[model samples]
Target chain A: MPDGFDQFVTDRLDRLLRYATAMTCDRYLAQDIVQEALLRAQRRWGRIGAMDAPYLYVQRMVTNEYLSWWRRRASRDVASPATTIAALTPPVGDPAVHHAERDAMRARIAQLPRKQRAALVLRYYEDRSDAEIAEVLKCTAGTVRSHISRALKTLRADNRVMEVL
Target chain B: MTNDEMLIREAIGEEAGQAVDPGTVLAALHGGRKPRRSRGLAVAIAGVAVTAGIAGVMIPLTASRGDEAGPAAANAATGAQGEQTILVLGLDKLVDEGQRPDSIMLLRAGADGSFRALSVPRDSRIDPESKLNMAYLKAGGGDKGAQATAAEVEKLTGVRAQHYVTVAMTDFPELSTAVGGVEVCLKKAVNDQLSGANLPAGKQTVSGEQALAFLRQRRGLPNGDLDRIARHQAFLRGLAARLATLEPAKLTALVDTVKRTVHTDAALDVLGLARRLTSQSGLTAATIPTDGSVDTPSAGQALAVDPVKVRKFTTEFFGNGPAPAGGGAPNGTDTRTPCVN
Candidate 1:
């Protein structure tokens, strides 16, 4: 590995894949987008890996790749089965959140606008702040706020999370 | 965190284990693409035409060309100079197909790193008898074609240029693909089969054959060739973005892609110009300021451009004052990026 990139990839690849999966709502497309981002990342990894936030940078690239793919897919208007949320098995302790209900929530989340979904994924899934999300999305913090607000509006409309939002 | 938020996190994290094989992804990076074959060059006309086009965007690998340019001349070109100009002509040429000069541009760069380019329409009046687009065909192509075209451009804008380059569209695709495709943002989707451009709306990276079509299609565009000039500016800016990070090895291949049409002048070799504008700054593009049109006794209806207005455009684009009316954004680049469509 060049400059300990092997370790860096090991540290970040899984996290990147999860974020990508959430963004694309498809495991296969997520893998493809992550691979595409990583391929491009390798070209400049020598310069970027030494930066203060190499993983964050690569994660941003993954987001861009997913957005690009999203636009491409949208224009083509092709329907894919995996775009639907997959059913999840409930973990041992969490009986209040039924797996089927979680699946319904995930599907509803996927229906939000791309920016909204990305904001939710970055904010909740990656545990990033509005400023950090802005940095990653290359948008103003206000725009990030709007994306989150609009996204949460949809979530709140769902009877399951009406009070939470 | 709220319980609902915690549940959402847990829901999304279910797929955290999903991943592509890193080894396969890494292996594909270098395995598929090998260096291209056959070297190419674009002959630069020297002595009279200014060699300028937002060289800010199309500049590639001056640092890599250091060995080729030696030390002295390379340094001089890269060092800021006082008052320079060049004529840049972009053409669409395909195998066994007729060639057309679709983009006619003039650029002026003062020593301060400020630059402006005027895109003259292909149908602009050169003489009462013929359109500016026919200059190349009248000269039977190649160097003669570029020279004849440059002469007409000189007449139209009244700017004497000693350096010129006529770049073919054939080479642009390979170059765009080489740089991993250039991102294009269109307010609306373009679908013109005649020029082979069938693109969806928003931002996308156009590569190779598709890019040729993207650069070629002028028909069915909102304002015909006029809008295509904006596309040219945008594509060039994308190309510029790609060039900023071009690898040293790919730079050689890129230079090998274009067939040169002019040769007598070494002062404005493509390599030197490419190196000088590697910085890609203070660039703007405009259509030659034309105030509507009139019918000539011999030439039918023609665009009416006052030389005075053009000079004013020149002044404002270089930051002397406010820009004159009639022109698109300072172009061949994305002023709206980082948060792309």
Candidate 2:
């Protein structure tokens, strides 16, 4: 690719990393997803990078890679040696603290089904509209709404969140 | 967004600022690009085509011992991404007579959608005197027939099949009718009771029962199974040529017909074949070339197959290496050189 493309990736790397990390919860998995998307983006840099929303297009590829998990299941099955589940697990501190409820809720969000978790993350974290999320997830906007509705309902049912509501 | 949504989003983004090495991601994509391709293609003969088409030349002669037409069921197969070698069979069931594996053809479909078809005559001896078709009968019926036929093909050609699709003979009529019928020509009229074929001389469009009869009859024709193989080649060429001219809707129906009538072993189904099809290079049908005739005391009359000839043909038409300098191999459609004696 052109030198400008390298500079572009260098500049946007942290943002893409943030999106991947938030979607996957695991740091290693997020890096892998971002890497696959970038490699694909590099191949189409001239066309895609020129588009108004190149970052969104690559983010969609990352989402697709996660959904089409069967293709890379064999190699990725191994847990990353460095990023222990305990280290990345939410609710890292002791239970009797002020942040207890918030941590517990984050854990529940992580436990949600993949699509629902993706929908919820794209909506609340990245501030994507339902139509934007649908484009990324390759589904109807109605389906995306249903996913968010279900995820939020599950979260709301949690006694701690119920108290807050 | 609700309060819970805001809180949840805030908690999820706690560790989003961590920097990951860009080198790591790019390396994974480059390092693991290949080695995922699974070799071998499963093949089965779709026995019939009832849907008529615009035009087709070879009428596959098949006899079914059955009460009514039934769906054969296409299945899936596993193959490499770039090119796949599939075994396409034409199967028939005679009432109380058992299943007859009438035609065997190996189709090599490239990543580019270029395909080359090689037909193996039923009379081609698997052993010194035994015919290739007997493999199905020897193994009994159902999946055993598919296995036995696949084994014979592997032994004959160097290609090892990992998947297959077997289709019923009756399904051809529906396919034939859908294409406005396949056109078949003959120099003289023919009458064959065994195959239920009675046709006049000259060119005619055949469909339904008539199409099946036209494809199934090779008894009176002195060449026997060899003539039938030619008819099979002609049938494929006719189908390919006709499909090239058909409306997309007609082609889709034909694909559906193949999907319904054929049974495959792996996930590589007819729809998969249809979707990947592009830049159709050319279609050539050829038989496993034999050097001379041989009559073995144990196996009766079998073609004296030249192994050297088979190797040359495969290398020319199917090898991954550069295509041979000259035109690959002699085609079955070329009536100039008699493919079968």
Candidate 3:
């Protein structure tokens, strides 16, 4: 009974954390949201564990947790030692200019609406197909495409503004 | 596809790569208990002991289990063998208004030294026209306010609070600085004039004025006051952890801050409770489950909390069951402090 759930956590916990971290842009929040989602999944493991792609359904939970976190107040609030954008600072050896560009781009992505940001992260960060992204976002594939396009359009416009500056 | 997309991918990769392993989470999962977070968070979970210690007053008792032996235990019972529940409040210092409790928590300290804390959001609906925070104001603030809030908590949770404790929000700065500083992280950089917060995105130690700003900034947060509450919880966790290991001289200063800022009922033994909590682990902190937000006629917008659910949750939490299932470790167990938005 418990083996499936434990195995699932062992197999997918890190990946889920990574997906959550990418989506939320906050590793601590990602860990928390992922843990919350997984705990909920574990509670109903009898049902969720039987599904074909439990990981996919669990991913949906993580996505919804990220979107609804601001809407529904998160319950457990603990202080993590390394928080915020500082964790996003690229590995030490990148060129100074490259680091600045990456930081600037990350800030721009953070500014996108949560859904659009999720779409971009799904496509670019996770390399997920539109159908897979749709399943997680609970939107149709067409909406997924539109989300990515609209996000890109905004990024392009912001990029031009930065260039002009 | 585009240069911008490539940049976005690279940025997301760098951030995602920072995701840490779920070692602590797994440990708790296997233990069938809440993760034992840092000594600081244990202090937050053990709300009364640490806060009262910092406030330099009686550590307010928690849990309605006082129904069984709480009242007697709170007042004269010297043997700390049974579970005790205490209502703890943090009062916000308003300029024109007297004061209102921004944080309301029911903390239960078990005989074994384990603790459970349940935080009721300030905006939780007490009635159709009023919120939980208003209970304090309606009761004319101060000790009376603590009584009113305690009564409301009792009514909501179906348990009686044997003892109550109150802390001033203004004292947070001094209390925070007294322990050197409380470290906090923000997901995004913020510059809010309303709360006097001007900080860059990253992990940094905050003290004095900055600490107050970090706790008070709600205007620009994504979840408004709820987010602010999270900040306060995290800060308390960090502060409590520090208080747990404070040196004798620094502890003396903290006690002075606590004395001026904290108010409790006459019965509680502050130092005794502090000693029990500081040396223990197994603390779990949770917020009352809320069903989104609603626009109230009297209050602008309030958290639509179901009293039934709240009571049920508390019953199960404070009840005799072996902790709630899937109890993730309370926060701050990780060596790294989590960054918040």
Candidate 4:
């Protein structure tokens, strides 16, 4: 491994893990994703380290891994139960009712089409612009806009989401 | 525009901004790399050599992992909050090796939880008769280009850009690949010999290298640079949507990619702000409407932008709503006034 490979791993490992978690919506799966990506990155550490942005190479690896998983499953759903809950549930669960409400919201968001849901999360949660979101989602700005519009319409129409909000 | 939209943005922002330990990630990476030298190798004949080899590699991995985690972890935990503006500058004319800004876009997020995106064309002939990209190069490069470009955009759009994210041509590939690939829609089959990018009309996901080609293709495009800009916008929107689905590992990879390829004044907190914005719902996108024309200036012939239409578009996009006033819904409180049940 090159001298900076270890440092690169150390420096970026956490963010990569978080990103993987978000993408997979499964913590364990996220771990596996990161591990695999890191392993691949390590294997090509010398060549990668010489590149302008080796992390980009690792990122590509991780996303490709996730996409492969999606292709294998033939289902586009990426969110897990925990992720759905996490997205909806507030941190402090003092009241069971609130928890339930959060869960409902999560379920509603989960019910959205995969691409639409992804667009909502990226545009709103990640605060990425249409361009950035488009880059990440592998689509055009017009498509991104359509997704957002459709996602928002669905979210707004969801009785549960409307009630919760 | 609506209450639901605001609440959704607040909720998503809060959730996405939550902190996690970068140390664990570093440790995992190091642990994965640890050499597995069998203790009883060759019936103990190679024990000493194997043990030495393992220790030599393990020690540094552990040491480096240890030092790298703390600061990054701290940074992640202390992300930014509230309304902010981020400038994303695209250097259009410059190729991979060149360093400068060719185009600029301003993104503003208000406390009311609304967003506005504005773009300035690269070829817009300005006072000095130089293309918009020259402003960045003349101001220095990289961070300097961002600052200079931001200042110029403020003059053009009448909105102050708070911070900027500058990406080189190479950064685009790294970035596009980092989040997987971006999907682009082609209206017609594109075979641009100059940029070496060929594609049939339709929807397709492109990798980093391909993305670079897509963004660079100019000739054969109906609107020329204008069409390219639209294509760039489409690519970005797709990329953002793709990123939204990223698992933690991929998100971390994105952060790493940003650290490597992007130059920005945005603090870790601001990136956090970006994360929150992405996690939210109801974000709207619109282009700064413009009618392109040719103009002759002291510098030479250049693309002329209709300043009046640009100004009107800017005001219309960003001026409708009141400036966002505060951070997301009060922490730990789901203030959504339930509408359904």
Candidate 5:
């Protein structure tokens, strides 16, 4: 209803959705996550505006909300090894081959534990500092570094991801 | 930390470039419904009968009638001068048999531009055998609760609470919807029968009633009130992020919403000051370090408020220094008040 809210939604919606997608590894669920995060922010605009980095705050919310959802659902077996690599392959290739490689990288990143994935996402995707990641995760900077270290190790071990990178 | 890591970070940043529209997200958060309590609701709720009952229950006590007319002086003296400390209190456990504070948080913005929130347990016992919820109730309810709670908090912590803001339960849904929705992480499925918040675990966006249910559901929580406080803090953090990305119109609508629902002694001019103080500051939220619970002789089992420990917490948070300019004398300020219906 306000003037800039619509524009704000339009401008940042895609990026937030991508963040959700990367976090959940599911486009539909990612869309839902972004939407919910935005709505919550809208309702508390007054108090939110009073904060320092409102975007980071919302991103943390989305991640935390996503984790809460994960906690509720029964854990499924990790996607089969065969399916995992296939899922990471980009659908559209040709001139956008680079985009496909990036997509595959994102898929690999999503397979990490929620916290690890979040650490990687914030560190690389959002380009946040270790301290910033710690703030969002409510952990110490050491914890964030450990998450990154472990996440990197996992990514390195995944031969397919290594090649893509 | 390495070049490879930096490359990965660039890729991730590129991926984040493709954010989704928040409008749809906002709709989903509100469960795809428009705000129910519009201007009409405010008008209807303001009628004589409602006012009479609220007034009767929430009359302020004239304990120390000092300078009530010097809010301007208080602002001028307190603004960005020296070592400033804000006291943030969250009223998570203040449930009165059936009623709850929804969520109450206090933030002490220091002069160094760092802010910390001191979460006051709702169940924590105060003087006169009242729980933490009464502080807000005594402050005339709604936004007044923050004011009353802040006043009492200053007494307990020996910190000057210069500004206060209070938001109601209904604001949760509207805000969630407006920002699209909020994403929260749960360790496992939460089917809170008490609050009626049923959800599968993992990352998910919740709508109107669901958001309220999530914040209000303490019985099903592992640590009960403690977990609830964590959730409230997480939600506040998420809400702050969503607010940063709003467009002009949505920002205006949000401001209008604040004008309607949020009650603060902070004037329009103080808005900029508050914003500056909070922005770029490390906002730390900590529960009032106490021994959790205390057994009272008259009041069976209650959450204990350790004045000595709380005093220490105040000192650490606000920096044990000279009181802010215009701050009244440190002694005789009573922060404990009972909220009895």
Candidate 6:
């Protein structure tokens, strides 16, 4: 409950949650992961808050939480495939036609391997550069680029099948 | 951006755009832990702080005398300037014949937070009449056991430990479960009835009671207690790898379990140890130097180790001096779960 930590939570909690949601594709898991990350961040905020980008450190924590083996094993069945469908379900009575392509894209994004999907989400959704994505992913910039490239290749392959259909 | 990129961004943005409940996060942040505060006001203030959104400034009240460290220093300052040497003892279960210290480890943490552990084989001769393991039973068996063992260790190695941590082998199950078990590799299948271990060769994750058995089996090992020491080192290495990769939530749970399970000296600084565990600073482990097997009148078969060689190995390995250039199983930061006998 230090001033810097509270202020950080007040300002960036929403954004962190959004990023987590995109990465996890499960709102509840996102909430849990973001809360856990922030809890840890606050514990050492005296050091983290002194960093150049405190949010980035917390963001990396959130990413790591989502990528953790236990988290994946626990949330694999409950989230992603099921909750993502629920979230992507077009709202009743709205024009659901134009959303079909975007919905398909979202589904494909969720189907990517967790790391590649993570790289895609960080690069496209968070508007982070490849270097920032590498830092968050704890990989080289070349590795991050490869992840993004491979993910884009998979999504494009799926799109080609859709075009043929 | 191209059309596909635009569609990807829009899809991700739309998928992620949802209102997050801020209350839950604030609750977790404010009400996360009470052990960091004084016992008297922990419950009363935690609830009020969570509900009212008002909490006191982060204070390192327990940081006195280097017992604990402030949050800022917990990472950057504590290990950056000073090192800590801890004597880690694993105690066996009590039966009709009383108990003995199962394993002894000399953990020396450097100023950079990296640690090197020296495992003293339990069968090493402390004197012509007594083995190293007998030191604990010679004295009364609780805290005195740790002190007696530390004294023996200091006499043998000429290095005094700043603190001691003792864990009952009975707690290994819960401790292993807390970290989701640890993966260990076996060079050959084990079927030792004395230790209740029936494990196959190669790498596998052991938890709960199986983990206890895995660490306890020594009868069938080619080197006996020496091989068991290797098993201990392998388990510690696997545990360290697991802990290093654990996320914050699991790390917190593991830390809580450790606080509840392990008994340490008041000045050991558990949080500081946790910080070191979390840091990327690696671990180097080796066993104390030994000559050969000896049939002792007091402790039966024991390893014949000279105290002079033991002190030299400790000084060279734990000291800033170069590691003893020779044949000791000194593995530095390999991070592999070594296949052990």
**How would you encode candidate 3's per-residue C-alpha lDDT over B28-105 as one tens digit per residue?**
566654342222232222122235323321122211111122222242234455667878776554212545666777
Instruction: Give each model a TM-score.
Output: 0.49, 0.46, 0.49, 0.46, 0.43, 0.50
- For model 4, how does the per-residue alpha-carbon lDDT over B293-317 read when each residue is reduced to its tens digit? 6565654556665556566667766
Runs in model 3 lying further than 4 Å from the true structure? A1-165, B1-79, B94-97, B281-283, B316-336
Q: Per-residue lDDT for A1-165 in model 3, tens only? A: 658999899899888888887787666557667877787888999999899989999999999977875332212111111111222222245577677677767766765777998898888977999999999999999999999999989988877876664
lDDT for each residue of candidate 2 in B4-105, tens digit (9 for 90 to 100): 767777766763544356565545545644111100001112232211111111111010000011121111122225666666656654211356666676
Task: Identify the candidate with maximal lDDT.
Answer: 6
Model 6, residue B235: distance off in Å is: 0.7
Worst 10 residues of 1 chain A by lDDT: A76-85
Which TM-score value belongs to model 5?
A: 0.43
Q: Clashes in each model (backbone N, CA, C under 3 Å)?
A: 16, 62, 24, 80, 89, 0
Candidate numbers, best TM-score first, in rank order: 6, 3, 1, 2, 4, 5
Task: Return the lDDT, model 6, position B277.
Answer: 38
C-alpha lDDT score of every prediction, in listed order: 0.57, 0.56, 0.64, 0.52, 0.51, 0.65
Segments of candidate 2 deviating more than 4 angstroms? A1-165, B1-80, B94-97, B187-204, B252-257, B269-272, B279-281, B291-301, B319-341
RMSD of each: 22.8, 24.4, 22.1, 22.1, 22.7, 21.0
The Cα error of candidate 3 at residue B301, in Å, is 1.5
Write one digit per residue (lDDT tens) for candidate 2, span A1-165.
546557667777777777777776655557656776777777888998788887788889888877664221211111111111111222334763336555556556655777888898788778999999998889999999999999888987864543542
Docking class of 1: incorrect
For residues B180-207, could you state the per-residue lDDT of candidate 6 as single tens digits?
Answer: 8888898899887877789989999988
In terms of TM-score, how similar is model 4 to the real structure?
A: 0.46
Tens-digit per-residue lDDT, B190-243, candidate 5: 786767779787666665667666666668665667666656554544444344
**Alpha carbon deviation, residue A60, candidate 3 (Å):** 69
Docking class of 2: incorrect
Better-scoring candidate (TM-score), 4 or 5: 4
